[model samples]
Target: MDGLLLQGFFRSSAAWRVRIALNLKGIGYAQVARHLRRGEQRAPDFMAKNPQGLVPALEVPGQGVLTQSLAIIEWLEETQPGAPLLPADPWARARVRSLAQIIACDIHPIQNLRVLAYLKRELGQEGPTVDAFARHWITGGLAALEQRLATEAETGLFCHGDAPGLADLCLVPQLGNARRFGTELSPYPTILRIEAACLALPAFQQSAPDRQPDAE
Candidate 1:
């Protein structure tokens, strides 16, 4: 097909983030459901598309496959002709990128599937220990983010402003991951408020994990 194709797994926060961006940008794309738990991402055919064997890889019609959720979203922002994912102001754009990186770079890697798999299989960590490990990192990251979103004057209805941007895409999915790991979220009022605002939109509502075709 000539349309965009998204390589993703249901319940993947990174994949979820991309889905939100696509929806927000009003892009039409097909989905290749790679079951991360079943090792579908590591399959040879899938690996050919993404050497890293990760979900949220985007296959452009003319261009080659794009890996990394943020990179894919940025590409969409640049090429697509829909919603604006970044602001006009350079400083605001930098702030949004910074907020997004807190989840993409700092929080996500530690609790990634590969890392958790290593902790469980290689290190022989028990269920509770592995779970605790995820919760610890997620909680700490949210705590820091909550402080910034609360204290910063730039914060409005969303992470950067009234409109959802790159940071909101990251924050919403990370919050979903946080809830999955049973992280108590009441402490982060600002984050929760932003999430509520995001969820109120059709884009966020439609892109949710539970709404995905492969959700289980």
Candidate 2:
């Protein structure tokens, strides 16, 4: 890979984050699809790249493989030059990161496919029960995020400002997962409005799950 090779599955929200960041930064990259449900991530070649066998592993030219979506996003924000994913002001940056973490750390960890599969295959959870499990956490997290975004002065057209940033990248994908689990979204108008604003941009729209070559 002369530039960047993004190793990810089309449906992965984590990978979706990286894709949006990369697009926002205007970086050129190729996709190396690793089908998570098919266990392609566990294949030896990819394992050498990411020991955790997760998607969204970025193969930088000489820097080797970078894992973890948020870490990858922060790395891009720091290194890349196009759009700034985090605000320059320290306090503003912290606020954006805090909002992003609620989705990336709290909501996603609970509702992610890994946990969902374990619930069904390992614990013998029924389909509806597993789905409810996902919706519960996503709903609660969105409620908090909605409250913060709605009331906070920092929030603008996107999560932190007029332009989309790190928090917006995290929000858009999690909302996709929320819809997948059937979470009621009418309550989070701020979040939904931000999502609408994000989708209007080319970077977010092009990085959508269905637009990926490996989709389905």
Candidate 3:
């Protein structure tokens, strides 16, 4: 295997997405723990790799550093032929991408650690207020997902089809974040069902936040 290094914080959902994809592809890589809460991602070394100072910066063997979980997963899909993370059909691929973006682009950003920290530190929000903010946005996203997944015939054992793929990568991590923030998941039965199926697989299990080396 060519040298691959993933610099990420354990609890980071973005990092978790990449971890699941790498595991699903059966790729072996070295991990560099970046403690986000301690501002380690902002340090000079990590910043050099990702000027955005974000976790989940992947250093590929010859392609230089790949930032962002979605892009890294797309690179893996294009380069590594093993266990593909995306659907083959064009329309199916678009559907999968749409579901993945719902979390990655819509939900995850507002509930991220930096955003929550800003709410508390910069805006002077109480703990309960920040928690409420997270739950509100996550719940809204889950509500939209629930309506689609429950009614859409395309949704299967996973988000798009029988096999776990890109959508699952995004879904599982956001579910983890929702649970962490005490968001009520009972309303999203389809989501819970899909989450259970994904969790039963070794890739998702091994890539979980609690299973990571730097997990607190």
Which candidate has the highest lDDT of all? 2
**What's the TM-score of every candidate structure?**
0.97, 0.98, 0.98
User: What Cα-based lDDT does every candidate model obtain?
Assistant: 0.91, 0.94, 0.92
Residue range 7-118, candidate 3, lDDT tens digits: 9989999999999999999999889999988999999988998999998999987778999999999989998967889989999899889888889988999999999999
Model 1 vs truth, CA RMSD = 1.2
* Candidate 1's TM-score: 0.97
Model 1 lDDT per residue over 1-216, tens place? 249898898889999999999999887888989999999999999999988888979888787899999988888888788889999899999999999999999998899878999999999999889989999999888888999999999999999878998999999989888878888999999999999999999999999988888999
Give the candidates in order of lDDT, highest first: 2, 3, 1
TM-score of 2: 0.98
* Per-residue lDDT of model 2, residues 1-216, tens digit only: 258999999999999999999999999899989998999999999999889988889999978889999999998887888999999999999999999999999999899899999999999999999999999999999999999999999999999989999999999999999999999999999999999999999999999999999998
Worst window of 10 by summed lDDT in candidate 2 = 1-10
State how far residue 179 of model 3 sits from its true place (Å): 0.9
Put the candidates in TM-score order, highest first: 2, 3, 1
User: Which 10-residue window in model 1 sums to the lowest lDDT?
Assistant: 1-10
